[model samples]
Target: MAKKVVPEAERRRRRPTRTGTVLSEGIIVDTALRMLREHGSGGLTARRLGAALGADPSTLYRYFAGMDDLTRAIGDELMGRALAGWRPTGDWRTDLRSLGLAVHASYLAHPQAAVLTASRVTGRPREIAVDETILGILRGAGLSDPAAVHAYHAFIDQSLAFAALDAGSLALTDEARAVDEEMWQSTYALLPAETHPHIAATAHLLARRMPHSAYPAVLEMLLDHVATRIGGGGGGEETPHG
Candidate 1:
């Protein structure tokens, strides 16, 4: 795959699409992202991407070896967006919280693409940079090497896991998603108090609130746990917003 790296001059010469549109990695990734949003994961095909770019399907091969490569590239693009202009404020917990939210927001913004790419290990520039940044933050917070590694694993995994789950719900069709929401309102919210007391009591609140993503709350919990373990007191309280 991507056997040879073409020189910049050659790449520039081949940049023009069949319709005289200029093509580059950014254009292809952006088009793919739009396709994923408009048409869902199934709608993103090489043929469709080519058509959207007004280029021959084969033209995409110059940039991406195949669809999977393109998918990983899209994932990396999300990571890049999340980390863009984000700087750690030297307070480890605050920085970690900010990082989690940024990553979560990026995925939620493109649910369809998130569903395809969240769990993947892209190892691309942005993905690797994110991993390094998380580890650095954890270690900077006074976690020993082993402990920092453990926390890094937990934090990153939890973030991506929740992103994928929430994105799956967002990617549901209008009819299907409505059914889920209706179930929360009509079925769960109206359960008999005699058998399911908790559901009956909190049903109103649950219906009102459960639609939001739980990633932010979960991330806060993880961060709090890690902070507590390392005796990182007075790290500023964080109110998680999903």
Candidate 2:
């Protein structure tokens, strides 16, 4: 019998012992992530990534079906990074708040990547773990399964939406930022008092407020609404009655 021969592709697929030219799913994903961060999602083409990694594009196809697959892998990597070193505290509010803020901060750190991945639902291990952790918190807070699921959906959706919006805003050029500022100072500040008295009155406060202050406050308000609906009643402008 003649000896069977392994193809070059299959040979490369085998794990490298010395690690000079490694070609694995993890390596592809890690490289894609770096490329994404450096070039933004728009700039991460398979050809460019393959060139950067010193591998044939076909090798990437062996690991990922296409760019979409590679993007999902990158999303999983981002999720893993966000959840790394995060352990849940028993207090439901604290745990949920921490998780939400951690995710928000992580996305902010990679705004371009966040813009690409925040809206995506990967359903990968880290994403599942996040859902489980959130459901656990809601359940601990005495929410029914349906309510917990609903709240979790709202929580995740709101967080990602806010992250995407923030990332988009943050990506503005310096001139664009100045234009936004001028809009606030000129147009928004000069609203006609007759038609928009309330807005005019609060324009000063709105202008003076730190741009990032609203996100946490809005998140707290959303949580407060969920708390109220769950009969937890710590929300809104009222003190708890004995």
Candidate 3:
């Protein structure tokens, strides 16, 4: 319940807190991300944020409409980090793969924050830039407008979906995580061969692979399909090794 609510546009004159640290959107989002990492999403409270910023809790509305607004901005901050200093190499498949990996890596680095943000639609600067850049990459590769849009949808959603999934696992407690990792080898591997022949057959492989992310391999398969669509096997036929 912020008092004297000031919308984003009206908060032009930055005021220093009692600690003399000026409050800006960047600082607020950075602090929020730290809080999200330290205390989880449920721990982000106005009183806590106010203490972190050395400012009054009611002053938050001067920059954002509410906590939800701040959350979106924090999500976009991850997006910004994902593409920070990223430049396209003009090769669509190569660039797309790099972008996908970059996004995945950023989320992995901030697992707790990623869990809260991976499914959000920020519509902020970084989110828009990443989408626009992906679209540009597809179109530059000669994908027709409709095809580019379709591919862009699949590409972005796939990245975020896997990010959310993997990040959720990463956010778990260490003991909990180890339990899940072991279950594939322990439970799945030990299934009787008579009734579960398929599992028994591939159980060893599953044990070796299930603990790792499926993102990189699945990304390659998707790119291979995209290459086929690019005609004459031009895009990623060789699967460019980094």
Candidate 4:
């Protein structure tokens, strides 16, 4: 007997699986993110995700090409969340700072998801919009092509790097995290002034500041560096490199 072939249009139409679970790309990605948060990075596997979604594992491929494709979707979801209510102000430094903070906050909110997706470039809609906004800000600042490209590169690289690092730290088990946090006081803070004068001198400040995320301060420093060169560039948007 020949297996009945379903029409493509019928398949693409809104439908549910045998388990009566309505699955869309958004729902899949959202569930994957929630699973990541609940179970940590290693917890989101095909079988487990299938069980969680109440659908067969193969049903996921109906929405995404494969796990890699789904991973990129997951990444894009984070970017979308970051940019959801965010609008870029005209001022470059102010806008960029807000963008940085928004991305970092989104990552912190979904640390396990961030750890898994932060280093993965989706090149999806949300990611492209981010690129457009950042480049727009730099070009709007009258930066030369080379300067704008450089700043854009630096901005994204630093953003992802810090997001990955901080999110990975947050993803650690509470006991592991406690040990890492305790090291500031137990190890570095206890260094003797005679042998480690610099560390010891700053130990007080380090104790006060080390537990917090440094991405905000780093963003300010990067903005300050760009400020020094923006006025020197003397080029409007679309200006060619010298």
Among all candidates shown, the one with the greatest TM-score: 3
lDDT of 1 by residue, 1-242 (tens): 55354444555434567777798888899999999999998999999999999988877777876789899999999999989957889999899999988898889899999999998999899999999999998877778776777788888888888889999998999899898988988799778999999999999989988888888888889988897868954234332331
Candidate 1: lDDT over CA atoms?
Answer: 0.85
Which ranges of candidate 2 are over 4 A from the true structure?
Answer: 1-21, 232-242
**What's the TM-score of every candidate structure?**
0.88, 0.82, 0.90, 0.89
Q: Which is the better candidate, 1 or 3, if ranked by TM-score? A: 3
Write down the lDDT of every candidate, Cα atoms only: 0.85, 0.73, 0.84, 0.81
| Model 4 CA lDDT for position 166 | 92
Model 4 C-alpha lDDT per residue in residues 155-206, reported as the tens digit of each score = 8888888988999888888899989888989999999999999999999889
Candidate 1 ranges with C-alpha deviation above 4 Å: 1-10, 232-242
Count of backbone collisions within predicted model 4: 0
lDDT of 2 by residue, 223-242 (tens): 88677766853233322330
Q: Name model 3 segments beyond 4 Å from true.
A: 1-15, 232-242
List where candidate 4 sits over 4 angstroms from the true fold: 1-14, 234-242
Q: What lDDT does candidate 3 reach at residue 138?
A: 81
